[model samples]
Target: MTSPSQILLVFPVGECGGAESVFMAIARHLDRSRFEPAAWFLRTGPLVEEVRTLGVNVFLHPITRLSDPVNFWRTVKAGRRLIIDAHIRLVLSSLGYGHLYGGIAAHQAGVDAVWWQHGIASPMNLIDQLAVSIPAKMIITSSRVAARAHVEVFGMNGIRLEVIHPGVEIAPDHPDRVASRQVVLDELGIQPGKVVIAAISRLQPGKGQDIFIRSASSALRRYPQVMFLLVGSEMFGMDRGYELRLKRLAVDLGIEDKIVFTGFRRDVPRLLEAIDIFVHPATAPESFGLSVVEAMAAGKPVIVTDVGGPRETVIDGQTGLIVQPNNEQQLSEAIETLLANAQLREQLGRSARDYAGAHFSQRTMIEKVEAALHSVLEADTATKAQRHEEGR
Candidate 1:
């Protein structure tokens, strides 16, 4: 058997967010015969255990601030040691601290590094910019729009930015929609026979769950059978206090009984099966739309804001509908349209399942990642060979 190359995945946080899940999926699907993956984390969270389940070594070196020299240097030094001792050939980093330490450590160990960009137009600090300039070999973004944003940030004269759409798991067999709907509705105290429309995302300011509530209220008046499920968790409940604001708005709108808040969930596929329509009303541009694609994978007709990554994922009319963001009237109309017409919903939902399965399978994502890594390694080798020839 050929020896596997060790790749170090340095994650900044342990949160089970979109970017983190993509990286974990990469690790899980990476060809073990040719590549071995391990991970290093800045702090621990629910995802740490999940990453460990991939049979990869994971280390946590937490730091509160960029200026924390003790932890920062200690972690960097540790990264160097890890690179050397574990024979790490490449490192992939996400987030601020991960880029800082992972880039520095890769340079220290004389290995290749790739930066994974997740946030949309979220500017990097001077220090992170410097780290990318010096040590990072490439950047991986989930969408072409995101790639363009990073290129502008990086001042792209010759920067290599690869747009790799994160993959989703296509369920082998569709979940039992009737049973799932019954269970989820019963648990959330949503009376049976009510139409379920859900926004499955983190409860953050940019996510626009508050906006969703406004539209849902409008839709509720038009179609009283509609109930909204807000399925997500607040990161320490700190979305500019948006969740509380949403509750207040719901009560004021007199649609409090029509809403259910299920904080953070593991049964995403089941939840997707349960919901009749998937709505993502992001007020801000998203770097990528994982949930939107995942919903499509679940064979659910989706509605997304006509901005950012969803533009790339959903074919507007073929798979799902796209409405202008923050427009309550438009959002409500889209919701009502889907709820009113079962034929349209079924047509879109079936196309969505086929599209997701063909385009976003987990194996395809893994292969793309592996190819990108190999390209960098091969380029490095060619450069070294050229340098040696010149010296001779």
Candidate 2:
């Protein structure tokens, strides 16, 4: 099948978050001969460099703030110029003001637009709704629940909504497992044969890092060799209070030395390789649990909170365990269970890896994204032709 000539993606953040990860995966794995992909980010950060390293053209839009009227219009003009100069046929946006700006700019440039929903934040304003709903040919959501939320909360039923699950690449084997385990263990001053329970996510209250630490405190008594590895940095602009709080909680519980904070490590796939078990105890709804998927892809058993997207990804007790969100006791119990039964862990891990490989490969994600883009572009063309006929 033929691919669109050129596609432009606009996103609000510059960091390597879940949506950005999916966007980069799609950009890297998409059929390059058919589709020329470019990206525009509001500010420069890790994602910009990552995308560029993948040989995708990236532009820095440099919007000071969403409320800055002059900068906002300037961004619109810049986006229009990008669309025209690049011969962009489609504009895909992730979320926030970027969606509104990208949709408006695409309309101004006479290009098809799609707003890719990545989260369920606040409702869109009237202007944003019109910019996103009227100018955009379709709305692409990462999950079915997110699509339904778009329709129910924002009243954007006029726009077509398509769900495309994000994908992850499974390593041929846990290639970095040995090296990463040695490095992590050495850095933590821990020895071999210690059970590692790893959870990687941005340090935030909603992410439940504190809950994990507190739960680990109790769980460590039974399994003193168990090391709790917290992998990730604090969220952008958020205070370091959460990180400090977790540390304090661990010290107060007398499990401080057993807990290790590896701040924002780039080798997450490798880190997942080294860990014995993975847990995601997010207190809030996760639109899609990319970290959990990554862990599963690494052939590790997972225990995620039974909320939002994890419910779709994790099959409780079969693939991995799913405990109630914010229940530290239950979380600890699940972790201990996986640690105690090596055979059960191996079985679940194998199932997880197989399930992730079958359902969440990068190729699968790119195909779904390409199909959505094709559908949106074709629908736009048909709508234009109908309008022309009616005018005649």
Candidate 3:
């Protein structure tokens, strides 16, 4: 039997976000016999703990700033040490900055790199493009839009790009959906049987929580029992002031009591179970709508902005509804329609869960990722052999 291929996965973010979660999921589920995975983060955070809990080897590297000369050298030194110590043949980078630093470090330490593009945006700098080009055997992206963006902006060849959509675990039916709803409602002191319209996302401007709040206010005038739930935290250095502004807006709209803010929840699946409708009104482009999928997995009818991966995930009028980005009227109308029709909501929710189960399971994601890694390694070896033969 062949020995396991050792890989060093590098992440640039300090906190656990969507990208960090995706890395953790892969590290947790990757085949141990075929691949030995290790993680290196720029700074220690909650994700470090999460990675370690999954039995993956985790290391911390102090990165003050990418632009600082002293920090850059330190980063290089750390990268070289980790690559050598871990016996890593491949370095997997999650974002652009991670790819840039990790690629240089892996090359210095003599290992191939694979840049995993999680965002819709392409690399902005020439060095970043070259770093990915020279050292990386392949590039893995999550969305077709991202792949197209890479080719259009950077002239990236199609051969180098591989699209792998992230997957989520479907939660089992909660035995205590009513009790769980009561627990959350009791904590918020909300009345029983209130219509809960929840936007379960990180409290950031790009997430369009402000628009959600405005829409909720409009919806509440027609249905006062409707309680708006904003269930997430501003952990990713996204505008903290946006959360404050949302609260102030709720107060100004005279619907502060109707709006509930639950910060940094650990029980998202359970929270999704409690929510009646899941609404995602992101103004910025989401490469993939993991939260929307998660909500669907939990058997909630979802409504998302008609952009990016949401369009791919949510089938309008079939699985869920898609509204124009930043259009509060459209968002409000969708929520009202779902709320008014229990039969339609049940039909869409069942369809959404079925679609999510078939398409976005964790097993599918792990298998696809394994295939991509093997393809890259095999191609790299063949190319090297060809070069050596040509030289001889």
Best by lDDT, which number? 1
TM-score of each: 0.94, 0.92, 0.94
Once superposed on the true structure, which residue ranges of model 2 sit more than 4 Å away at CA? Answer: 1-4, 121-134, 174-180, 384-392
Error in Å for residue 259 of model 1: 0.8
TM-score of candidate 1 versus the correct structure, residues matched by position: 0.94
Alpha carbon lDDT of each predicted model: 0.85, 0.83, 0.84
Better of 1 and 2 by TM-score: 1
Which runs of model 1 end up more than 4 angstroms from their true locations? Answer: 122-131, 236-240, 388-392
Q: Estimate the overall C-alpha local distance difference test score of candidate 1.
A: 0.85
Model 1: lDDT of residue 67? 76
Relative to the true structure, candidate 2 has a C-alpha RMSD (angstroms) of 2.5
Residue pairs in collision within model 1:
none
Tens-digit per-residue lDDT, 163-223, candidate 1: 8889899987634668767997788887888778999998987888988999998888778
Q: Which residue pairs clash in candidate 3?
A: none
* 2 against 3, candidate with superior lDDT: 3
Tens-place lDDT digits, model 2, residues 1-392: 76557999886778877887887777788788768899988877888888889888898987786668899889999999999998899999886466778888898999988887787534544544544554677877777777766777777657777888888987797455687778867766778888789889899888888889988987988888888899988865676677888888988999988989998887787677678899998998777889999999988999999768888899998899999998999998998898789999999999999999998888888988888887777787799999999999
